[model samples]
Target: MSEPTPQTPGTARDDRLAGKVAIVTGGGQGVGRGISLGLAESGAAVLLVGRTLHKLESVAEEIRAAGGTAECLAVDIITDGAPEAIIAAAVERLGGVDILVNNANMAMPLPLSDYPDDAFRTAFEGGPRVTFSLMKLARPELAKRGGGTIINLVTSAAVRWDAANYGVYSAVKEAIRALTRAAAYEWAAEGTRALNVAPHAHSPGLDWWMENNPEEAAAFVAGIPAGRVGDPLVDVGRPVAWLCSAEASYLSGATIPLDGGQSRWG
Candidate 1:
């Protein structure tokens, strides 16, 4: 993919997210990277969190070069203390957290009966558990800022259930979908909104699948009404950026499908 186009200094479209701080897990690459850039471009100071220091730093540098504020932290979200540490870093580096994007996840495709127990456990630990922990940790920080938004990156497989060998992965994502809705409803009074974004984008995971199962990948792409898989930044990042902005203040407890009409769920 091409490098993200840099925005000119002092030419930001609008500072809807000005003065806000955001934490984007898995912000080193693919959809996470896109969201981080989109948020930064919209005038929010961003903290990019992921396991790879180099990848995170690269993305942070890109944001900085684009005249956006950003910082990078390398840490595994599944670790016991990671959530708290991420929130702390955001607070110390960017002032405070006004948006949280729980986009870090493991994509494992294994048949249900053949799936290893360890891998299944790892899936849940990495997906729902870590997301829950992060949301819980960031709640007070968001509240401190009067209000904020949380966007959980999910998959179309979780809702459609058409793909084989995705049982475990889909289940874990479904759990996150449930948690997102509950948080949206319960946290409404606290001014914190929660939602989900289901995107179909070109990423390393999709590349892997395409290389291993060319026929399946082709069929999947054929199903998209948009005639092509989405660009991570142009397609997925824009909607997520809007979700984190004040314009979407009234949107909560919903899942916005970014799959270009591939999935019927609204």
Candidate 2:
């Protein structure tokens, strides 16, 4: 584990997660990268898992440069035996898993009527199926450590009324949400916590969309009450760090929206 230090003026990083081990899926880029950085900054050893070797290595390099311990494992989470392999890697490498971040999700946005079977299968296999598998495999390891935290990356579109062509995507995310809640309840006695996060943060995908369609992007930003897109590291990651720490020991199962008030969920 890395020792905490001052990250910026007036902000002191603490050793709240000192000696802990966290495994993050899709941890090389975007929100996943943000969370990985966050966990590392908070003094946890992070395992960065994703499909691209270079991307995972890049993030791992960043963590190492910042005096944090991190390892990279390149593998598609949707593949067979991936969940088992990930758990084994985490235990064999980082000692054990104290936190699991299921951040990799595959989905094709299409209307229910227009959605194809193969697309749906891809979404199903990549999202909730893999998430469930990882959670199932990580439970015993988590329990062995007296309990752990699981964070599932979800989407606000899952609860939106005008989801439109997001039926397939929303369904997959919603299923993950359900799994989070169920795990929160089922694992409570064991001290394991599970929660979902719906973050609307800037990413490479959003950057491309904004660059290609400024008007639409501007309109979308305008619709957000915060008046701007959230920073993946600050808005999404730091808060998630809190959630994974003792600070949020009492919080679990609920979906925390990091959209800067864009969502109106009760």
Best by TM-score: 2
What TM-score, to 2 decimals, does candidate 2 have?
0.94
Error of 2 at 142 (Å): 0.6
The 0-to-1 C-alpha lDDT of every candidate, in the order given, reads 0.86, 0.88
Worst 10 residues of 1 by lDDT: 1-10
Q: For residues 37-136, write the lDDT of model 2, one tens digit per residue.
A: 8888889999999999999999898888888899989998887899999999999999999999999978967789998898889999999999999999
Query: Counting only residues 3 or more apart in sequence or on different chains, how many pairs clash (N, Cα, C under 3 Å) in candidate 2?
Result: 0
TM-score of each: 0.92, 0.94
Q: Given candidate 1, what's the lDDT at residue 185? A: 90
Top candidate, metric lDDT? 2
